[model samples]
Target: MPCWYYDKKELRETPSILDGISFETERRYRKEGARFIMECGTKMGLGHNTMATGVVYFHRFYMFHSFRSFPRYVTACCCLFFAGKVEETPKKCRDIIKTARGILNDNYFYSFGEDPKEEVMTLERILLQTIKFDLQVEHPYTFLLKYAKCFKGDQQKLQKMVQMAWNFVNDSLSTVVCLQWEPEIIAVALIHLASKLSKFTVQDWEGRQPQHQRWWDMFVSDVTMEILEDICHQVLDLYQSTQKETHQSSSPPQKPPSRAESPTAVKSTNSTVIMLSSVQQQQPPPVSGNGNLQEVNNIQSIKSLAGGVPVLSSGDAPSLPQGPTPPGQSHGYHLYHAPPPPPPPVVPNVPYPTSAWGVQQTLPPPPMPPSLPPGPSGFYSTGGRQQQQRY
Candidate 1:
């Protein structure tokens, strides 16, 4: 019942982005990290789910950590190494590191540090803690295939559309869409996007009816064109992004110095650069000041909050009345209720968790009221088993 979904604002202003790294730069870092995970997973013969889960962990880990502090590629390796075990496609840490080394250039590979296996193992621990050990991540891939099955279309065309949607789902790992929406929602939106791009119209579906003319309605009732458009645009942005060069476009242009001032400016700039370099080298990445998941550290507390199972509060305790009662009324609060045989309290109508855990979280039936066991005087007086009062 732990909610992992966050808003676009949180995604835009991640810890790395707040630590002097631009949002675009952080995003590119995520993409490159995801790419690294995918390529490593594939080369290691891991399944799509394993790689996707690893990429998801990579994204979520950076939510609390920073790209400036941690090498994204190294973290990517750790995620894949961790994700393999979670997804049951377990791979050795050395194998993963070796695969990463083979794929990365010498400069990039140096990020692994000496004893790369140990580095990845250490990061694996941090990655586990960073993601709050919410290891079971859902991707758009499963939902895409499931929904594609429901579509009433030509077999080959449907195959192509589903394949395209599947590819879209894979591409989406590079984006923050997983952090923004549920897998089902992402699947629906991508399928809609794919259908349009592939020119495949959904004339009917498994649950064809007057009210259910649309396909998404069957899976997700509240899906809209705008929401779908936003999702599609996020995924499409990757295509546009891929075409663009990965240059430092966001850097500020240096001002030219005059001949008379050039030497002084050069010395001043050199000194300033040295000072800044030293400071940057020593300074750790900045932590984000605010977000919905500011501190998603405690697993139990998050689950309890999600479950709306609050700890006992003063408001729930029975308080004594402050003022005297009128002459016509009794001072006892229970006098008017005839509590000799009180009716059971009505359970409040709280919402069930709207996630996979919902079905598994069914409440147990209320226990039957205990009958009065005969005392020495042939009557019982208190609640609980054997007159043992429960807190």
Candidate 2:
């Protein structure tokens, strides 16, 4: 068989990079494609070996072809479809396409064109050529199991270590580590990593040879501490990289802690009013008529994220700045709208700004109060009523 192994230098610059795709983008695509294959296969009731075979095929195919040239999602589907046949658990092309359609959104499914079946079948031939018809694949799973059997220690710890190693094998598939080392070496490295993490040191084992100084030496004489650690780092980095994304998605960014009050402090400090999310998401910070800096932490802006948002301050309220003239000077919009509308028994024929679907829609005929003098309670009055303003 042709040598499939490559060094880190070569993988760092893949064919996708040469085709104008950034290294980061290409790396992201590889992970997403492998994940797609795994998810699609799981839904199809395919075995782990079948999915692993598909993922390997995916990585190998991209090695020769550019991700810019072919869509990753389509190639992933083709690989899964072909691996099913090679692994003797074939699924129908239509069934696979249906599964993908449900998993992928319209943007990804658009690559399948009018007839997805034809798209996958046509790519199947190119995939075969790229992999050079190397249908026989041997994964680290078998080697991991074979080497693990020799480990003599707590059976439960051994089982847990084996399980972690197996997961490492699965995760390692998403990386180019498979293309850089043989399956036996990867198995040894991962098993060693798992043993160290589980704190189950294998001091004694079966088939102990006098020449071997370490447990791993019995299997691979060329293996060293550096090589094993390198493999371990490569696998561990996958978790750390994804952890950042998970953290970002989990927190859901609380609107960048609304911009602080402008540095300009005139005699009559103009306190800014802010319109936050619907009451269902977050409540506005309690602001008294007295000068108290409203808390800024818990607020999500309803505006576009292009610029800084106005903050809440308790002082003399200022009229809102007029909006830009609407395109073509459309009469449908109001150029100047005051801050939050006050109670009735005041001014009429006023249009307030509201949102329908992100557009600044106009609410017609809402009675709004004109600028009133400050009340004894230090609050602004609207029609003789001191209404507490909601941020």
Candidate 3:
């Protein structure tokens, strides 16, 4: 079998067409990707670890495969299913297919019903060959634990950062960063950014100067600060956009003109009078009082009223920033538009289960390797046991 890593560089650096897509389009793709992962794990009744494992496997597959030819959604589903098997969690084909149908458009998702037994078997062979059968994936949970314990303040912010870091790794799979870095380094970068985002003050804020202390110097050497900076920039971009979009229109009014008289007060008073007539119609109604009504109208300008809470409704779903461009300018795919008239506010009644949106699952104890005493630095023989080995 041909090695999957033959063209790994191209996979990481090549821009997927979806990179320049609009926000809504990008959102749909994410939804598809998320759904694909969910279905793969749910099929075998596996927990979140298996789902996360699936994401890693999917990324590995795409590293060698062409995104243009293979449908990403389908590839995602295949990778997750394969990961479940490798992790010793077997799922039924029917259950996986059925669940996908329930949520996806019936017409478009019909392909799920087709038998994947043969296709999965083929993919499994390809996956094993590509990875040389290596299945061990390093997760950031351990690093997160270490960081959280060491940094006592901003526990909630640190926790959120940990989660964000985990997601950063997931997204980075589709980017160039994964090509050069090991899993441990990637984890470190993500956790570092998460800490930055939380803005948590370190325990020895003043004491741990980089050049002054050997301990601080040693800690920095274990991770790549450069990559951490890049990841931090990306994560911060997403966060800023999410914050900019405040959900409610009725947050609060600006400080009421002021306690004493000021220009703002005059402007606010004028704004009120102008809004009343403007909203009423283009032509003002005939006034009962000749001078008073005209005098009030003359003082007010409608521009201030026009500025109040301008609607930010987007035709497409919002997404994370992509490529080298500043995230403020970059918009993800916007595949579809909303109805001509704004849709009525929706109230979804179905309560979401914690597991559904991928809250971390309780992990099973990892198997420990038997102690083999000491050995040489280079590869050792299997002693004729004919067992598989992985790096």
Highest TM-score among the candidates is held by which one? Answer: 2
Please give me the total number of clashing residue pairs in predicted model 1.
0
- Candidate 3, superposed: residue stretches over 4 Å from native: 1-35, 38-45, 111-113, 153-177, 205-224, 236-391
List candidate 2 stretches off by more than 4 Å.
Answer: 250-391
Tens-place lDDT digits, model 1, residues 133-211: 6888888887888888888878877776676677777778878888888999999998887676556788887866678
Candidate 3 C-alpha lDDT tens digits along 1-391 = 3232324345434334334333333332333464357444554567656766766666566555544444555566566666767677766654554454443442234333234344544566776666667786655555545544555456565555555455555434433343445555556676664345344435453235556342234344644466567654543343232222222112333443221111110011111122222223432221211112332242122222211111112221223233344212212221222232357445333433433222222322234554343335433445644333344
Cα error of candidate 1 at position 335, Å: 86
Residue 126 in model 1: lDDT? 81
For each candidate, the alpha-carbon lDDT, in order, equals 0.63, 0.67, 0.43
Question: What lDDT does model 1 reach?
Answer: 0.63
Error of 2 at 214 (Å): 1.3
User: What are the RMSD figures for all models against the true structure?
Assistant: 25.6, 21.4, 24.7
Judge candidate 1 at residue 150 and give its lDDT: 81
Top-down lDDT ranking: 2, 1, 3
**Over 4 Å off, model 1:** 246-391
